[model samples]
Target: MNATPTEMMTIAAARLLTNQDVCFVGIGAPSAACNLARLTHAPKITLIYESGTLSTRPSVLPLSIGDGELCDTALTTVAVPEMFRYWLQGGRITIGFLGGAQIDRFANLNTTVVGPYDAPKVRLPGGGGAPEIASNCGEIFITMAMGTRAFVDRLPFITSFGHGKGKGDRAALGLKTKGPTKVMTDLCVLEPDPQTAELTVVSLHPGVTREQVQAACGWPLRFAADVAETPPATEQELAVLRDLHARTRQAHGVAA
Candidate 1:
């Protein structure tokens, strides 16, 4: 099957996770990305779920952290406290993959509310363990589709701190994670500027224009001095991704 832009984004995101990475995987796109990595180049990558499943190698993508597939395939399961204390906060995990309702230039995420916290226009699923994941992991990789609504100028509420205000804010707050290091979107790949720690476009997907990306973002987006075009997903990657999703649908009884 040919890859869609979203699939391309997932493949690109998966490629970033190396065999050496111990990734703290989220449920949605993050789960798919990590699983793809495990199926492909990053076969040795350790996957730790929020529900305490460690080194999980599920046959299909899990619906949530509590899904039986995760625990069934995991090397071992620990209590939530031990998962957080000994694995996450203990500085064992290398990458934290996240998604957000709204993201700012500094990559601070808001999964709590859409509008004012007091009287929100939309109340979103509150961050579950994301704050800890953001703070404790060695680095964070955010995957989201780019849109003006999602790429907001000011987040109404910050559910997980990224670079915060940029610069040394994370360090000032005593956060051990390096904060958001990369953002993979349907249109492009963004990374923080080395000097300012502000999110900047580092690569664009095939056929995506700079103007399109700029228009999607709420704030004025920045571009690296030498932006590169993201390579399209190879046939092998597309096959793996398709198979993964197919099995996920089959396992859940979703129509193909």
Candidate 2:
């Protein structure tokens, strides 16, 4: 059988991160992608966590930023405040790995509330350190499963942050960081427009169609006029990615 969508997403994210200068990673998809990069390429990258761990080398994806495994494998865990202030806020982190409860075309994220701010739909896990990471990290790499529910036209609340307000806002704000550098989804890879930072599908998987991608997104999605086909995962890439997931599931006690 071919790789699953989740596996494809991880591989796309991993390839993008393989050459990042530095990464401020969150848990889950980002963790898997970051570790994949470490195991393959970009060994010199400095991986920092919001929990104050730096240069961690975990054999599996972390359950959360504060998981003890992070501390154990870290080069050295430092004071939390110092981590945010001295490193993150100081703009030392070159890339940030982000996931979201909801996202928009601009790659803005919301993890605070699902429906009305006052009351309504589900209330997701509060943005623990996401707000800080979203704004502080030099650049961001968003990883999320593609579905109408998750990639909304607009988020109910602004939980974290966006690339300024819209288009040229990030540049106008004099932000040196690249904002969101890339977005990896199950069916395609998206990139922000050079001028507007609006997300456009740059590449699509072999069997995925533009109509299907748009159908799956919550909002009216945009596609590049000339989108390219994504390169299929090489045997080596697939093997490494599969091995990583197997190891992660085993560690987390996922039922065999």
Candidate 3:
């Protein structure tokens, strides 16, 4: 079966993980991708959730960080304070997987408010652990569907710092870890420019065009010198991902 764009994006993100990685996973798409990696190629990958589940290997995707399945499947559970103070802030997490309501050219994320701060058109859930996750992780990977409304030139509110304003911004701000190294979208894969720190298109998903990517982006998009085509999802990847989703739906008692 041909993979949907969302599935392709998740698989692409999952491929970036390694068995040696210790990932601090966010809920939603990032959760699915990290779990997919564990269920497939990166079986030994350590999965940590904000709710204090450490090294969890859930059979299905979790509805939230507090989902009981996470703790039940975890090798061990720690206090939320310890999870942050020791594991995350102590530089033990290799990757921070996240998604957001909006992202700017520099990859700064906004999940707070859509419009003005005080009186907003959409008051989104405030950033939970993302601020610390973005700052302390060895590197960060983002997953979100691309759209003009989401890939904005300016964020209404900066929820998590990426590259900040430009190249030296993170260093200037005294951030020691790499902020956002890659952003995997439904349309393509983006990485920070080596010099500029701006997000640039490095690979287009199957059948996705440069024009389509630009149309979806809110700013003037840039492409790498040798942009590559994202590999189509393998049968095994699709099968595993589908099975995971099916189980999640069944467990949650939702109609598939």
Candidate 4:
């Protein structure tokens, strides 16, 4: 009857995609949310991967971007270079779904080195194609677990670009694609400021307080004066999401 935090986040993210959009889906939360969209409202939405697979429909969560299921179930598989050159860089792909190690107020992400680029605190798996995804995709949506460490006022490094020079700067940079359109976190949904595009809490999930959301965020996070409450996920949404995760773990040999 109630929505798990993940399911609520997925529903919130799913609503952003549409049948007319071509989406570049990241692994984990982004994958789950994108698939939810395909199964629910945006059945015709085309899903793309960095590995050059398009329109992928896996019954289970993929272990990684390199998983064979993506290519196997894809509508077509292009060469890695071709995929970016034509589909992404060519300005055909409409949406990019991504997750990162660190996010800042400007919504820029850090996926390269953890603390410093050279002498890092914790070196993470470098951005696979996230930079290009952010740069070339028509638009993007980011999904990540919200914790004080992951959400900060300034990223440890700028691994993947969002609103690098702040909002409105993207237009001045002569970029074709817009910056991150939204971010879906466990306790809330955030959108960039209209001018600066700095991220601020726009809505709080049901039963979540502004203080709780702020405590979880790393930075001195700001909240809208009139933030709205997030609607809990419906029965149908929970069933689908739970089943999907169950099958994902069972098929991948990953314990849930």
Candidate 5:
């Protein structure tokens, strides 16, 4: 069966993880991506949710971090304070997977407000643990659908600092984490330019065009000299992903 772009994006994001990775995972795209990686190539990948679930192996996609499936399938659960202080702040997690309402070229995320902080044009779901996840995890992996509206030249608020004002800022501020390392979207994969710390397109998904990716980005996006085409999802991956989504929908009484 052919996969949709969203599925392709999720699979592409999952490919970044390895069996050795311990990821601090968020819900929605990030959750699906990490779970797919575990169910497929990276079976030993450790998935930790913000709610203190450690090495959760949920059978279906969780609706939220607090979903009972996370606790039910987790290797162990810890207190929220311990989850933050020991796992996250202690730099035990390898990847912090997140999503947001808006992201800037520097990879800083804005989940607080759309227009203005005082009286916003659109108020988003305020940042929960993203600030800590972004600051303390070894690095971050952002998963969001690309669009001009979601990718902005200037974020109204920096809910989760990426590289800060680019290059050395995060380090100057004494953040423990390395900030966002990769951004996975429907069109392509973006990584920080080694020198500038600005997010640059490094790979395009199958059947995606460079123009399409550029059009979606709010800034003048940069591309690596030898950008590669992301490998297509294998049959096994599609099967597992579809089954997960199917189970999620069924559990919620939604049509598949």
Candidate 6:
């Protein structure tokens, strides 16, 4: 079966994870991708949520960080402070999965407001743990559907820093961790340009064109010299992913 764009994005993100990775998972697409990795190839991958669930193996996708399913299936739970101070700040997490309402060319994200801070066009949920996650994770993987509004030239606010301005910015800011190593979107996989720290398309999803990706982005996009076509989702991956979503919908009492 042909994979939907959302499924393709999720599966693409999932493939990047490994059993060795201890991922700090966010809710929504990132949660689905992490859980998919756990349910499939990366069975031993540890999934930690900001709500203090450690090594969680939720059978159904959670609605939020506070969802009961996360705690129920977690191997153990700890105090929020311990989860942040001991686990996150201690540098145990290998990857952090994040998404945002708006992201700039530098991958700096804004989730606070769409317009002005005081008089906003849209008041998005403020960043909860993303700022720390962006700073401390060994590397970050972002997953979000692309749109001109979301893939912006500038963010109204910097909720999470990817590469503050350009190359060496993170080090200059005294953040040792690698910020946003990869951004997986419906159309393509983007990696930061080594020299400039600007996002550059490394691969396009099957049937996705350069024009389509550019049209969706708010900035002048860049592509690698030898950009590759992403491998289409395999039958087993689609089967597993669909089944997971099916179970989640059934468990959540949502129509398929």
TM-score of each: 0.98, 0.93, 0.99, 0.95, 0.97, 0.98
> Any runs in candidate 3 off by more than 4 Å, and if so which?
none
Which candidate comes out best when scored by lDDT?
3
lDDT of 6 at 52: 97
Q: Write the per-residue lDDT of candidate 4 for residues 28-47, one digit (tens) a residue.
A: 89999998888888889899
Minimum summed lDDT over a 10-residue window in model 3 is located at: 57-66
Model 5, 1-256: lDDT tens digits are 7778899889989999999999999989999999999988899999999899999999988887988999999999999999999988888999999999999999999999988789999989999999989988888999999999999999999999999878999889977568899999988999999999999999998889999999998999999999999888889989999999999999878988
Q: What lDDT tens digits, residue by residue, belong to model 2 across residues 28-80? A: 88888888888777676678888899888887777778778889989999999
Deviation (Å) of 171 in candidate 6: 0.9
Local distance difference test, candidate 4: 0.85
Q: What value does the lDDT take at residue 249 in candidate 1? A: 97
Model 6 residue 137 CA deviation (Å) reads: 0.8
Which residue pairs of candidate 4 clash?
A: 167-196
TM-score of 6: 0.98
Q: Which ten residues in a row have the lowest lDDT in candidate 6?
A: 58-67
lDDT digits (tens) for residues 123-207 of candidate 6: 9999899999999999999998999999999888899999988999999999999999999999999999999999999999999
lDDT of 3 by residue, 15-34 (tens): 99999999999999999999
Per model, state how many residue pairs clash.
Answer: 0, 0, 0, 1, 0, 0
- Candidate 4: where is the Cα deviation over 4 Å? none
Between candidates 4 and 6, the one scoring higher on TM-score is 6
Ordering by lDDT: 3, 6, 1, 5, 4, 2
lDDT of each: 0.92, 0.83, 0.95, 0.85, 0.92, 0.94
The CA lDDT at 96 in model 2 is: 89
State the lDDT at 188 in candidate 3.
98
